[model samples]
Target chain A: MSIPQQLILTFISGGIICVIAQLLIDLTRLTPARILVLYVSLGVLIFAVGAFEPMQKIFGAGVSVPLIGFGANIAKGVREAVDKDGLIGVLTGGLTSSAAGITSALLFGLFASFLFKTKSKRM
Target chain B: MDSKAKKQLIKKHSPSTTILKNSIMAFIFGGGICVIGQLLSELYSYFGCDEKTCGILVTVTLIFIAALLTGLGIFDKIARHAGAGTLVPVTGFSNAVVSQAMDAKSEGYVMGVGAKIYTVAGPVILYGLLSGVIYGLIYYIYRTVEQMI
Candidate 1:
């Protein structure tokens, strides 16, 4: 696909995903935390059904920028590990694939904590 | 007034959320973030990295930026208007960890920053990993069975 087309699809997919979550927040009692959990798990389920790759092929980063992509990444890691190492892959694959994300979040979070103070929300 | 009458009175006076406006904001900001990711991926690919590497690089770069924004106290302000546009992306995950760590700073580093860092994002990691493992187990068994047949 052309670069412009890819970016447009990414934006639409990402926007639609967020809109769905926004509607859930405004229309229901589900907290943001719960919605995050739901989206991530949904990603894993989509991967499990073998639909994640095809959807991603079309949606590009739109499907990836959201937490669901993270969930699918974990599942993808597990599949690769299981293929390579049998039972142990189930134990190590998820973390192995997600290690980059988890570690970056941790290191950056720590650095930010030292460099800046939390500000109270301004209304 | 009776209890039901009081409830009705309160409900009548309470302001309702403008759902349409919030949805439009979410669409713009959320989609904009993804476009940024796409651009970053394209930049990385232009530098000769393959698709997979570009994906990882884009994620890392975005997380770093999100952490910086959270530290600068800007993420939450944008989130106020963007709503799930910010919350639904990987950047939100970074903000969750950084914001919690910043809040717990008063409690000291180990008990405060270290332990509290994952308070919000913990469930995401925990459940994501659990589901991945479960899926792996099922996939393994299915593959093995198919091979035997």
Candidate 2:
């Protein structure tokens, strides 16, 4: 049952997310950038409040890949920063801790820009 | 006979041939990605970071590279060769941001710069979250079913 449970949920959940996303694109003015940031932050906030971990266990990358695992990294970074840098870590810890993800996101983004046709989708 | 014969000939063409092309492309491009990764590893050693730090450094460096390429309009070219093979990686993240930024910039500051920059990435993030939520619900259901079974 648990095995079937994972399959059914993965299919339905993943499908729902995609469908909702399509609707937003068709219906709303909100852009995907805000959505992306919101999700990562949401994950971070949820995990902080003990909400997202169970999701992480179930979906694996489904939970972590969007922000490229930075949410969990930021939380851990905050704790580390608190341990090492004291209060400043709260301010800077996310940057230093999740630096790898952010940095990779930025760099690979630049590299990919070159590798592909980055024509604006607006027009 | 002529029209039917042509139709039959077209039908004989398999989609797998296209898949085969893509699979080979994936191998080449995937290998390229790995090679770049390996080169980054070498650079990490040159800088004398421990193995752990080096791993972080490589990823961070790649992020910048991807961003820069996105800005310059070159990464897209490479992505062509790789398909999702390349796009699924960190480089794709960079492409998403850069392109979104460009799209947002057209309508002047408020709409373009402030609001529109997230057009592409917003959905990716949302889908990601919703997926997690659904994943959670599914897992919960699974647990219930297991208990019942």
Candidate 3:
């Protein structure tokens, strides 16, 4: 696809994903945290069904930035690992594949804690 | 006031005007973040990183940026306006985790910061990993059945 087309696709898909979350927030009692976890589980299901790659290709960051993308990432990792290393990969693949993102988050979290004193949020 | 009267009064005061603005802000901010992520992925691909590595790098970079912003106290401001726009991204995960730690730093390291850091985000990790294992098992079963066929 052309650059503009790709951009449009990304915007639409990303907007839809957020809109769905917003709808849940408005219409239901489910907290955002719970919805977020549901999105990840949904992502894993999408990945298992082999639809995630197509969505990723069309929407790029739109799909990939969402929590569902994270689930898909884990699914992809495990699939690849299992193909190569059997059942062991099932256990290790998710962590190994997601290691970079997880580790960076922890490291940055620690660094932030050390550098900044806690301040109560002000409305 | 009667209970029904009070309910009506609250509903009357509910800010419907804010919904349009909130949705628009979410679209713009959320789309903007995704655009940046797309650009990062494109850059990594251009640099000859494999697809998986490129994705990992983009996620890591986004999380780092989110954590930094949370530390600087900017993400919260943006989040207040952006709503689901900011919350929908993986960066939000970083923000959620790091902000808790930062918020708890006042109480001390071990109990305050460490114990509470995952207060909200712990579920994301726990459930995400659990779903990963489940998906893996399903995939394995599917593959085995296909082979038998």
Comparing to the true complex, what docking class would candidate 3 get? medium
Which scores better on DockQ, 1 or 2? Answer: 1
Provide the lDDT at A30 for model 1. 80
Q: TM-scores of all models?
A: 0.96, 0.47, 0.91
- Once fitted onto the true fold, the runs of candidate 3 whose alpha carbons sit more than 4 angstroms away are B1-17
- Candidate with top lDDT is 1
lDDT of 3 at A103: 77
Q: Which candidate is the best by DockQ?
A: 1
lDDT of 2 by residue, A40-107 (tens): 55556666556566764564323333343445555655555555654454555555665666545534
- Cα displacement (angstroms), candidate 2, residue B126, comes to 5.5
lDDT (0 to 1) per candidate? 0.92, 0.51, 0.83
lDDT score, candidate 2:
0.51
Per-model RMSD to reference = 1.4, 12.6, 2.2
In candidate 1, which residue ranges exceed 4 Å CA deviation?
A: B1-10
Per-residue CA lDDT of candidate 1, range B74-127, in tens? Answer: 999999999999999999899999999889999999999999999978999999
Judge candidate 3 against the unseen true structure and give its global Cα lDDT, from 0 to 1.
Answer: 0.83
